[model samples]
Target: MSDGANLRGRFITFEGGEGVGKSTQIRLLESRLRAAGLDVVVTREPGGSQRAETIREYILGGGARALGPMAEALLFSAARIDHIDSLIRPALQAGKWVLCDRFADSTRAYQGANGKLGDDVMQALEQVTLAGVRPDLTLVLDMPPAIGLQRAASRRAAGAPADRFESEGLGFHARLRKAFHQIANAEPRRCVIVNADRTAPEVGADIFRIVDERLGDAAPAPAITR
Candidate 1:
């Protein structure tokens, strides 16, 4: 059901660890796309619209303690269902560019990598949960786990609670970083690794360049069919 369709719009996903600047990059890309007069829909995974946002608080907040790995994965899948139905799929059908912060890749990293669940389990869950949905291009911002954690802590100092994942020790985050790297290595065509240690503007420029390359020298196809 989520097979690539003749999409007039491009689906670009920003993926990364806790503090790798996924939010900043997504905003940068959305702004750039809009500046060019492209129809753009900016959204995020685990939470996007009203209902999904509620689920996000539960999953990311202290409530995660009540949910086991399977439960947690299911909750994410549920949120994604709402996200795609309410946001992603509709925007793609209308030929509006969709810039998403995080997607199924997070599941693989957090649940598959950090959760100690094998790739097979994660892949299977994705198949069933997502109905074969996949991003056209995924920009993964990569950085050291230590640095990312520090950045996350700093950002959350007064914003909100650190949550279960954020509260996790450095070793857990290291595994997450490794998991993201493995995804990039395995899916080179769809996943690009952007070093996030650079200045924000520079990182933004890299993202823009990557999208341009993906869109190619010619105009994008009127319809994108998988």
Candidate 2:
């Protein structure tokens, strides 16, 4: 296809503490983008590419629970490297909008905020892993930690297990939530704070509005239905 056939892809990521509904909103946004007849690629991290997915399984399974924050950061960085090379970059280069459920912001929040890893270390990891491939927009779904934890708990099936991050104490989750807002405040231009402690449709609508405003002509035609 000619260059005129597709616009340069937009890299958009959704970030927040656990159960803020990044997955659901990504799906909604993907549907809306598809409805508008755009090529949208939906993915997530610390998985997306094969290696990353394997890393995700280990990390989220709590198998890596004993590892220190710095160690965990290194693992995530390694996964991100594969994900970028194998999936994210190629999709973007092909002029497909990439909507990610979580990105680097997740690392900064989950590990740097509550864990031993510091901001300097996290930033360095990002520099190495991202290789300058930053998201065009990041929508942070914000809500109370307690509420989010409850929601996350309710999602589990009977006898199911909680992930390492999800099993963190209330204090840790609270700190994680604060870190995300800090990130948004630090980068107001690239990040939008969405109140996610509401109904699915309400939160989704707010997200779509922010996306529409930032993306302008590039966003889907007509406003998002939900």
Task: Point to the candidate with the largest TM-score.
Answer: 2
Deviation (Å) of 67 in candidate 1 = 2.8
Put down candidate 2 lDDT per residue, 49-127, tens digits, no spaces. Answer: 8889999998998777787888888888899889888888888777788999899998898888878587788888987
Q: lDDT of each model, Cα atoms only?
A: 0.81, 0.85
Stretches of model 2 off by over 4 angstroms after superposition: 1-7, 219-226
TM-score for every candidate vs. truth? 0.91, 0.92
lDDT by residue for model 1 (83-182), tens: 8877887788787788888999998888877877787888778877666456889999988888888888887757677887888888888888889999
Tell me how candidate 2 scores on lDDT: 0.85
Clashes of each: 4, 0
Q: Which regions of candidate 1 are displaced past 4 Å?
A: 1-3, 157-159, 216-226
Cα distance off (Å), candidate 2, residue 187: 0.2
